[model samples]
Target: MKKNLLMWDETLFRDPEVLEIDYLPEQFEFRDSQIREMAFQIRPGLRGGRPLNTVCKGLPGTGKTTSIKKVFQEIEETTKKLVPVYINCQIDNTKFAIISQIYRKLVGHLPPSSGTSFKQVFDAVARILIKEEIVLLVALDDANYLLYENEINKVLYTLLRSHETYEGTRIGVIVIISDMDVDLSRAVDARVASVFRPTEIYFPPYADAEVREIMKARVMQGLFTGVLSESLLDLVVGQTLKSGDLRVGIDLLKRATLSAERAARRSIEREDICGAYEISKYLHLNYTVKTLKDEERQILRFLAERSINDHEMNAGDVYKAVRESVSIGYTRFYEIVKKMDAMRLVNLQYREGKGRTRIITLRYDPIKVLEYLS
Candidate 1:
């Protein structure tokens, strides 16, 4: 039997998808300066020369990815001389995987995965770009992962130093990072740094008015004319400023609209906004959780389960509980916990005194985590 859902009789949203984080609104706001800088650096490619290598730095939801994507869209429309490609490092992280993504972007389909080696794919991409007489610009979003795994220099060697093997080909690179102040000299050797000659462009946190302007555009596009109230807008903007992440406000608006719809309300009330704001607290993850080891995922799963009956857990006891399900030593268990804490996935704090040891706190909504993990 089909279960009945208490959906609202009145529609509160016009086009709900406009509130999504990934949606590209008709009007882009408060990023004109950053966009101009990116365009200036990449303009050289239009003249059949390699563009300057760039390092784009910003906190999460500070418009790093969105600006890159927007500028690339404009570049594609103006000229065919430059081919723009974007790769998320967390997802296509390996040397071969990264190369394969560039290849797919150019070749229109991925090369045969089973029979191709790194050298073959590299040569194939180089030949295609050179034969077409086009310079390729690659944007590596969340590039710090490549540095952490000791893979940045190796990948750069394949791209920057490829002229040694494949004559007459030139490539441009863009690295997007969350920590604007990372030491590139330490992360990569002198050769890679010299070849890259990266020019850093920073994106600052959005101001309250800027955040409101952004929300206003999305609301006009997404919500009904009379459904959203000034009070709800004020609440969303306050939460956004407090969190310092525009995505939090966007997420809260989406969830709050859904809450109102579910309760059969024509207009979103303060209670619906409150319910959504609660879940938006921990929604900012600058990078995806794709890098978690199998063992770490097991630990997350275990803790997520434990959170059902317990709000917090003693770090030592949680390790004991995790060992029953996953085959990891006590030492490695603590190591993984420390690692996740550093990555900001969960809050693992060390304790003091004779009896206290450590405490573990989940930095995400439990209901969402279970839905995502399970």
Candidate 2:
């Protein structure tokens, strides 16, 4: 039994790195236009000219961030005249943290954890760029998170108009926005907005043919041939389309492969794929719920409970019910619902008729949510 437990198959993957989400493929399929557009906007920085501020707007998992990374990788390989700075706004959504990240990319050291101020870091970053005679092209991925945190305008104002404060210092900004609900320009200062008059590029959802091609490419690079059958691959691709995100398909495939491996299978079969899909959904829901605040979780539980009986309750109704368990104001409740909507835990739709209430439609398994917290 011990020997059997240790036994496994290495027949699938030639290299472990190929399957990692962080792995950048040598060949990027189905994003030629985005890659080219990003390159064009960023190319000016290499020539000692201002980079055209760029905005890559797309839904989550639409290759927006990866395409930017691919171009930045190429830029780094070919030139030292420009430095590429990538900061995920979700983790470093504050003004200070974002500036510190830029400073780290430039100086090869992190800013002091607490003592320094934003102005000090900004001044140091500016002075270094000026002394080195190089441009910094910064990509703030998932930048819309800044908006939710009310830091979007500050980040944009700080980056786009940064050069204005320092004579002869050049910094190009690329904003990667995943939230399509908000009109960001109206939220920022006009002067700051003027500097961010960017070349806008959009990445739409991939078609089924496109998804299949992507899966096939990943299969070649990640798994051994025949480890995943065409039919099972189609199953993943078809289900992934419902979300219109290729990363979900890639994730589903990787998780499916791991599920198969656990069963000591030589190849991934239909049952393995089915098991992977269900497990992935559960894990995804679990991880998201794990990140919520105690109060947020409390509200989520109430909504799930509310939805079980009514199956799409009014947003106001969920809040009123939740208040009995936790003393939260209506405004706070509305904010929590919006937060849940952004998290994709529930879908919020406004009704124009019959009462004109905001409808809350949960996106996860309500029964599992109860079990999840239990």
Candidate 3:
């Protein structure tokens, strides 16, 4: 009788080793030029010159944050004179909150939240940076979150123009955004915009071949023998491209591995990949619940229902459908749409030959959501 190679129990093996798979770059395969150009901007700072302000924009999971972060780590290792501070604007959306994060990073102490006015907090920070005469590089990740809130101008005015306010102190700002074409020039006052004429860097999506190479590298380092069939790798790449997001790719791979482990299988087969898709569907829905505001959730639910009645729906049609069920203010509704676009829940595009009109589609297949909801 032939023995099954996949048979296993919980105690059969030690834990699997997945290399820095979570960080985008360990699994990141391409973008040689991007790293070189970005490195050049920071290298000059060592020789006592102004660090360049760079704006990194790309769809989610295209490695914008990861690539820059990698370069940051390398710079920090190479030089002790410069300071690098990174803040995520999604969580720290307010100007005060972002400044507080930077303060704590630079000072090694959290700024007191009580008994300190906003101006006083910033004044103290300026005084310290000036006193130390340290070169500061502040990277604002997810920068677009601050634009519409009218916080961009204020934050930029303080950080970029601090040199003018406090003589001999220099600061650099690196803004990371998801949308490249978002017209933030008008949102920020000209003074601040002119000061932060960031070198624009766009991160395009990974090619299908690159995606396959990334997964193969990850599987070799992360999985044990006989797991992850060649056919399954192709399946994962195809689904990831259709989804048009790299987080989806990571999510799929992680879930599939877990599915195999749950079944006590030493070898992951085709069934495991299929099982991973089912698991991803559940996880994606949970992410939707966690990140989206109540209004955004309602809008998504409305589109799920409308998509059932009709296959493709534009932005206006979906908004009308949502309006029927809720009393949402127009401004709030538009804001929710933009936020959803940022989150990759809904796809937005301009209609070719249709002036100023945009088309919207549910990024996920509705049948999966409707079935899950039922």
Candidate 4:
């Protein structure tokens, strides 16, 4: 019994970082074709030519960001000619902030924090790329956030038109969109769309066998031998499929392993998995809710408060309720609701009735959302 227990200093994880959500694995399995396509698109930049703009579309946890990261890693290791910059659009959705990130990567420092016009920063970035003779490749991960904030066009227009502003400058963009419902063509205006044509690449959800393989690889690398059984691994895979996000499975494995270790057990048990899944299933919901603005959270609170008695409400009712507390118009309210729906925080559907009413419902438990917001 003592031998089966992990001491205070001992842990079941061989390498705990492997289970992390952001850790880049040495063996990025099952994404060869996508990586090849991305590399091919980026090949021109390696040779001092402009890389083709690309749109990587997929649901959350489908390796869209990872594929880009892998390619960017290779680009960094191989050459000084191409400068690959990855921007998390969720955080830096504004045009100034996005360009600042590029400037920081190239200039090795940030621009002045205040009182600087965007053109000044833009010109500085262009000048560096031209003088250094470097091709800039920027990856806007979670680009749908830019669309939600109405900054997509400005950001895209600036990047795609940078070459026109400076004759010797070359730049390319890879827009990684986790939301499949967002159509880039319709989202951008004609002027930006004419030059911002991107080759669309889709990453469908991993098949059941592929998920099993991925989970198995993580288990082997992250855990000690015999810490998790084959039966329990299958359970984790099923839960991952149900949530439709691979991050949940990876998180569940870590949680369940900790649960087992706490119980002084060498091998994971069914109860450990069952207990961890209750919290792990809400991983995506938790993250999405955290990224929402204050107004978006207020609207969610209204829906949660209403959900106690009514499971659904008319979109107009939600808009009116939201407007009473927040100073936003109906159009902005509608966009907020649509954005929430895309993030899977709420379910928005149109009813075939008088004048086609839009209905809104909370996708998660109201109590959980309120707790998170509070």
Give me the candidate number with maximum lDDT: 4
Q: By lDDT, rank the candidates, best first.
A: 4, 1, 2, 3
Q: How far is candidate 4 from the true structure (C-alpha RMSD, Å)?
A: 1.5
Worst 10 residues of 3 by lDDT: 11-20
The 10 consecutive residues of candidate 4 with the worst lDDT sum are 1-10
Residue-wise C-alpha lDDT for candidate 1, range 96-168, written one tens digit per residue: 9999999998989988989889989988899898899989899998887676555888888788877778887
lDDT, candidate 2, residue 250?
72
lDDT of 2 by residue, 1-374 (tens): 64433255354565556666567888878899888888889878989988999888888777888898888888899988799999988578889989999899988998898888889999999998899898889999878767766788888888878767898888889988887775667767787877888878998877789888887888878888778888887888886776566666677778877777787776788887777667655545775677566888898898888778788788776776777779999988888788778867889999988778899988887898877866
* Best of the candidates, TM-score: 4
Model 4, position 244, has a per-residue lDDT of 92
User: Which regions in candidate 3 have their CA more than 4 angstroms from the true location?
Assistant: 1-21, 24-28, 148-150, 184-187, 279-289, 293-329, 341-343, 346-374
RMSD of each: 4.5, 3.1, 4.4, 1.5
Better of 2 and 4 by lDDT: 4
The lDDT of each candidate is 0.81, 0.80, 0.72, 0.91
Residue-by-residue lDDT tens digits, candidate 4, 1-374: 46766677878889999898888988998889999999999999999999999999999989998889989999999999999999999888899999999999988998999999899999999998999999999999999999988999999999998877899888999999998889999999998999889999999999999999999999999999998899889999999999899999999999998998898777899999999999898897788788888888887788888887889899988777777878999987888888888887889999998899999898889888888888
The segments of candidate 2 whose C-alpha lies over 4 angstroms from its true place after superposition are: 1-6, 9-11, 281-298, 320-329, 352-355, 367-374
Clashes of each: 1, 0, 0, 0
The CA lDDT at 360 in model 4 is 89
**Which wins on TM-score, candidate 2 or candidate 3?**
2
lDDT of 2: 0.80
Evaluated at residue 144, the lDDT of candidate 4 is 93
